[model samples]
Target: MSSKKSDSEKITIVIVGGGIGGLALLNALSTSIDPEKHTVVLVDARPSHMHLISALRLVVSDADDLLNKAVHPYGNHTFRNKFAGNGSFVHGSVTSVKFGDDGKGGELILDNGEIVAYDVLVLATGSSWPRPLGFPTESRSAIEEHIMARRAEFSAAKDILLVGGGSLGLELAGELKDIFPSKPVSIIHRERLLLNDTYPDKYRIAVQKAVEDRGVTVLLGDAITASNSSDVSTSQVPEGGFVTEQGKKLNPDLVVPTWGNRPNTSYLPSDLLSSTGHVKILPTFQLPAYPNVFAFGDIIDWKEQKGAAKAAFFHTPKVAKNVMVYLDLSERASTCDLMASRRSAKYTGCMEMIMITNGKSRGLGYFNILWGIIVGSWLITLLKAKTLMIGRIPSQTGFTPK
Candidate 1:
């Protein structure tokens, strides 16, 4: 618990989670820190980093090779070769983190009972949603089976009800309409506006109009409640259309929940968490209780919409630089000022940019910082829906495309 590593020893930086923020941090560290001084470890429960946005289309289309396309193996030869002696990837879920005395880093307790000690810790575990929307399985075959089963359900159902009018709900509704236009697709969102409140009114209206134009029924400002019982499972398909809080009833053959993401920070210390269970980080992206313990992405309590692109672009570099400062301090302990280094590595928030697509063809994009510019379907399709930025992940992580 002394939280000290000798200068001769390589500083171990354990990054818990291999999602966008974690992997980006690994890539950034690979360039910033010298291998002789530091060794980085990328840890995750999954064997591959999933392109979740790509999986949305796959769920609707039932693409046979989507598993291959959407998931990129962390054990890729090119990615491994780039890190070489500098870093390595570990496949295991972190069950708990045992912090060292003060804010000087600690040990990661893996679910498999293995312990990983770290000089610096980066928690980028991100957030989780209901399955089929998000792949919960680590194995490729398991994910394939999950998707196929969902596809079968979609195929058989005549009426589908998607709860929540957020981007995911709208996108899934649109995809269902595109694939099975004959089926009745409806979205029941508690909010009158589409998307979240973070977005401007014009942007939300544009998305609502676009989704409605796709022939999908939009039910706004009504919360879905079970008519008889409050014990309705979040993932359960309703027996009959559930009533709203105001006594309106809706019946759908299949109900897919598409809102709210819980942060994957159950293993984090309670003091570091917000009331909502997300990790609380300073503007420098470091936890107050543990400055050497940096966190970002959806897991952090940043008041903004969470997205993979945003995590990769904004959070990763700031974390990598701060970690490097710690490493450098460990090396030149006599000279470097830790306080100055932490202050210099401040992370001012990023601009609000979002692209929500309705399946393959149409969607809306908004860059609020850029004078509230709105992008149309063609731009959205070209930028995201067509590929879901799958290629970009591999490129950023230094993995050759399969």
Candidate 2:
């Protein structure tokens, strides 16, 4: 299918990826952008928005319908109804995108041979995670099938070994122990501490304490042997038990590597990206070469740690404001008034604040302030652990969590 604007004067805004960053921008444009002057199209591979904040909880959860809450279908009236007549949500994986020779507009081709033309393009495609946390970029049913199978593995496994001491590894270990209390859960990390040096040592110790309090074993300053771990599909655990670099042998029924991630920039052009595959953008979030192009979320080469909170709060507003400013500059023949109203909308970065839920009831929080402020479990549970902020989906993206 192709996108055809009813009026030639209307600007076509094509946004790629329906993750947090994409949805936030969609909400901004759908509500404020002039329907008569511009059209919006959001393209995504999946049929629904996968809220992965609570993904660890879902895997260990006995609740069958928790998956429903995690994945909100695009067919929901709350999401589709919000769009103006010209705005829409298209489901397909973008194979490639090319801006027009004039650099004013461009067109992208999907895997299914559909072409989508746009006056302005936004690349919000986030990172690709492991199974359970991430699903196949196919239909909603396919994703559900994959998750259900992974859940079965979690249920049947006698013991689980998680590689990496990152936030996700810690959370997964906590969730497993929480649900299956008797099950042996262990985490192996290359670093001596539970997390990286990004946070204070005090905060990292607190995080380790929180995980250990739940009887989860953590082995620090160690890594899986190269013979066992491979470069391809790190998420795919080794078949049998493996030996650590320190020569410690482990035999867990399920092995999950929770380390390393790559941005979903394979479909993007190399010129617009850094050496690491992250999109290169100016402070305005627009591509330096393609002024009509913008990128956000995990795909952008930003200094901040990639998370839903940063994408929703910081990147969304800046891109939304700048997109409109660009549109006004494009539509108006006069430049003086538009230039006066223009704000570059710079994202300077925010305080390093982390709220990690160990289980349904216990967790840890930290804010990188003066020295550091370590919040208690009660606050963490109250804010994130209880529901993982799933209830806020409707208000944030106009889609009910279910």
Which candidate leads the pack in TM-score?
Answer: 2
Which prediction has the highest lDDT against the true structure?
2
List model 1 lDDT by residue over 129-155, tens digit each. 765566754576776677788888889
Which residue segments of model 2 deviate by more than 4 Å?
Answer: 1-9, 76-82, 231-240, 333-342
lDDT of each: 0.75, 0.79
lDDT minimum window of 10 residues, candidate 1: 226-235
Model 1: how large is the Cα RMSD against the reference?
Answer: 3.7
**How many clashes in each candidate?**
2, 0
Q: Report how far residue 108 has shifted in candidate 1, in Å.
A: 0.9
Candidate 2 per-residue lDDT over residues 155-185, each given as its tens digit: 9888788888888898888778777988988
- Model 1 residue 132 lDDT score: 53
